[model samples]
Target: MATGVMWSLCLLVCFLIGAARSESRALQKLDTGGGAENARAPPGPARALSAPSIAHDGRLVACSGKYLLGFEPNGSFAWIVPLGHMCNDSISPVFEGEQVYLVAEDKVIKVTPRNVHTAEPALEVFFSHNTTSGRSEEIIGLAISGSYSSLFLTIRNRGLFTFSLHGELQWSVGPALNLFDYHLGCKRNVSGCYFDSAPVLDQCEGALYISNTEGQLYSLYVDNRGIRWIQDLGSHGKVMTIAPGNSACLYIVFPRKSIVVGIDVSTGSISWTQNIGPISIEKNLPTVDSNGWMSIGSLDGTLYSISPDGDMRKFLAKTANDSVIHVGPILDCSGFSMYVAKTIVEGKLIQTVGDYTYVLAKKPSFILFTLLAPATGTVYWTGEYPGELSNLLSSSDLNDFTIDETVVLTLLSAAKTGISNTTQCYTRRQKIACICRQAKAKFVQADPGEPSYVLLLIFLLVVIVIQAVAILFCCIFWRKKRLQDNGLQKFLEKRRSLHSKRRILGKKILELEQRAAEDASSNEALGQLGEMVKVKEGVERKLYESYSLGRDEPSLEQQGSSLPLYHDKYRSHSFHSSQKESITIFNMLSDTSSSEDGTSSCSDDSESCSGTSSGEMELDESKSAEEAGPSNTANVEEGVQHELEKQHQHCSAP
Candidate 1:
């Protein structure tokens, strides 16, 4: 069971929205005045920390024991989300879509930055795993696909695991990973394969490249999942870091050997190798600018910029007594700035060219980041922070990365004054910044819904749809009106005739009922009364139907109905006068007369109707239906008289 913990993070609902695009990399100027020290870590009690990692949206995230803290680009506290005790050994979190995925111990947890208005819980345990042998596998690092839709997790002493965004395990390498035996086969002088960092994902080739501690380079295909290739470069100490090159090459840095090896991605072969001086930099990877040059600060006291092709030049070299880079030289997000992970250290005077400050323990060390021109090695901006950055994770793409023009001129002036990296003042702990507000490169948003045009387009489409619906309804009502026009008068006549027939049937039923009472045993009168009642019910039903057919028209007012009226008045009027008689004599005669000259031209009228269009046919059918329902006034009266005469004759004969 995983121990529960509560965490909180501020939700920027508009963070990825198009209207907020300009705001993403925009760093609001932070005020360092009012009780806050000019150079210090975020205000909190000292605790175990992790290296800061940058989110794509420019938010800075790092974990302190059970709490994960996010800072704005301007170094202001953004939010602190709680975590579980199982997530105590936390690595940097990765951002995908809107959720943050973090690996702690053997569990993968997802933290959603919920909007303040949302009541949903933010933190959830996505996955928990242990080796089949019951061995606890601590996850080392997490790598994401170039598309940011999938993830790959590397566990110490265990194999790699790839997962989809929805937490479905896509594939796994091994329950017990022996990279040395499987990939390297213990062929070279290497003894064991240890991975200390996440695999570098080559988005172009759709493959993953990783180097073990023993210099065993391995590549795995993303889409294929299982197939892999490896190359053994003997041993170059523990592989410090691996970065992508201009082409399909992997730059593997071995700090212990002070060597950077470029391996061809396709063949898994070494392309070139450049020797950097005695290397002390560990976690900081070289910054690859747009020009395809890699720049890194080494313990040799030189900032080395190497071309994509095998070439290296010292961007900045220190004299024998000059201080060296202590913490960073880590590049910024736009590939335009460099910042050392801010930390606290105690050292002697190093260099305070502008607002840059770096403190080291006891000895003197000048280590930080600089905005260097790839071609000229011009230092536009540089800064240092107070304290060790062991556990503090932050984004390299932090937005407050610019400095003022005067500060750049001051630092540049030192080159002419021959006093560069000379002016130094020792400080116990300090945070520093200079205004270098250069233009930020524009990034195309994934969800491109610009209010300037997309909103207008959406609105126009909505209006068109509404208008189309209105027109459709109008046409429907107009068609209904036409149908009513063809049948309205015929329906009215049919209704009156039905009423008259109903009256006649009522009188006949009363007479039969009276005769039945007078005889005391006349079943013939009773039977006739029953039949009359049934016919009366059917006539009343037909009358209700005629009114309903014309009910939709305003011409048909809401008259009080004597019975249940139904829709489709035209069809209702066609209902039989009785179950035994499908068509009444009165209705049949009216229909025959209305169609043609009695029955003589009925065939000609039907032939013309068959050739009519659907709209005309509908109207004709409605009219015929109405006429078929008690529309022949002469016929209806004569039929009633004939029925009464037949009844009287039968009674007189008996």
Candidate 2:
């Protein structure tokens, strides 16, 4: 599990390194933003930005002020698109499929990464809000429909809006939430008749859920283009978050009341509602674990776990009033919980007497990170870091270090007790490997930014490429070994055939030993046996020049009127087998499996044995087939007829 999270982090780190590689030499003199963004940020204030989105291919896309930028996965800029109007620095750009949707002042712009060079990157306005002359009409939230062909957004007090993904306005609904606007001190008859929350899609039932300030929930159909249902909970507060619940319901959180309600996705009916406790901040949203228990945070410095049936259990993270539970609980797939809290500490920003211009807050805070046991909320470990983090929600730094723990990475841009304008980066690993960035200079100077992240990407890329190449070569080598074994099988069969013929020749020459003096047929038999002996000798010599293919080829003497060599063959022991070792492909698969030679060599067992490898046997059979054949048979018969006449004439002279 840690390995899986490491790869995901490697992807994020690699893409960030890719962006840093495109930084110009002049960019080093400024802050760490790109392009038209350098003017918005100086050497200080590292927060002028939009939320960056990582594509499936690992490219990072984000917007700064009025421009959209793209970075490749291997460290280079792909394209940049400019929007004429300014964009909200707080709003995050949404990437759906291959396109990007982001807010630009009063318009929602769609960008296509592929056609950035050929055409305008901001292809069209997906939706545009008609603004009232004096009031602000910024988009509150943006989400894409499950079909990936539609978009939904909530304009502050104006209501809910929907559009086709390709720049077509489908429909709009003005919520009836403004009846009690006087309670919140809104003007008598302005454009904001109702305050609406962003639309959240529940993919299970094909519906979108949204809430008004009066606690009224509206269910809208995604495909048929109409309002499905609406229900009011009879409470008044800001709808802080809306989440898709376990199969049957949709969960909504109201931070003012600290109430979490589960609304049925189909009928907009409230099934279960429970108030955990009052939360001091709105960042404490709820998260559901693997077993369907939802966990949330409260001002009491406690983590609360609520089951789907509305049973609530609380575990104390700190003594009440000692620490602030600023963020909610986060659960991995295995039900391990992560909770964040902080305690306000009274300390000055400056630690030394030297002249320092970068003054910090009088009460700088310290953050607390706790890893809790699954479902029990038992503390596994707590990490405390200096400096303040607004909330841990949606932090890209969230990563798994073990099956149940995570590595904590903290970056301090503004130091309260260090040299002026210095930045500190700290990492704590839990069963994971990490590289720390070290800087020795006391004063803030222009150092090469993102050096450690670049080194990490370079190292990971090199290792993965080498492992792939090693596996490929191993496959090729084994394939060649299989083919050599097949040729050896054919060579062994040929050796067996020649040895059986040798046994038959010895038997015939013995039978005709007496008949050579008495009959003509015996003379012919004597001639054929002599020719067979010579053919076997030539083949065995050519094939097994280095090792014996069979016992040394037989020697036949043409002493007059005799098969005398056959008569004395049993006494001489001429067919003894040679012993020689052979080289093998793999030592583990030694040559013990080789077929033994035929029966010509042994006087007792009548079976010869020799040590020859698969490679040597293959070589011997191919050479013998090419050189020895049927032409030698016809010549041997003519020699036998001439010799018979000389014996007959010598008898007549006697």
Q: What TM-score number comes out for model 1?
A: 0.47
Q: List the residue pairs that clash in candidate 2.
A: 18-75, 349-416
User: lDDT of candidate 1 vs native?
Assistant: 0.51
Kindly report which residue stretches of model 2 are placed more than 4 angstroms away from their true locations once superposed: 1-43, 50-63, 67-82, 113-124, 134-136, 156-158, 176-192, 236-240, 280-282, 289-291, 319-321, 328-365, 371-382, 387-654
lDDT of 1 at 386: 22
Which candidate comes out best when scored by lDDT? 1
**Candidate 2 structure quality by residue, lDDT tens digits, 84-123:** 7787655667767677888888888887777755754446
Best by TM-score: 1
- For each candidate, the alpha-carbon lDDT, in order, equals 0.51, 0.50
TM-score of each: 0.47, 0.45
Q: Please provide, for model 1 over 1-654, each residue's C-alpha lDDT reduced to its tens digit, 9 standing for 90 to 100.
A: 122222212133433353344333221112211212223323222234465656555555666555555655444556656675445433567776567788766678788765312688767887777566755457778877636468888876666778887888888763223554663423443334455467677654578876565556667888645446777765555455777654455677776566888877768778898887554454445666544567766544566777757788775554423445433344443343343222222432433333223323355443343455564566655444222321122322222223222212222222222223532321111101011011011112223234435766898999999999888876654454434665656656666667667878788767875795575334345434444554566666655543443234334222221111112321211113323332101111234344333222122236543343223334555355344334333444566868666766887995
lDDT at position 383, candidate 2: 53
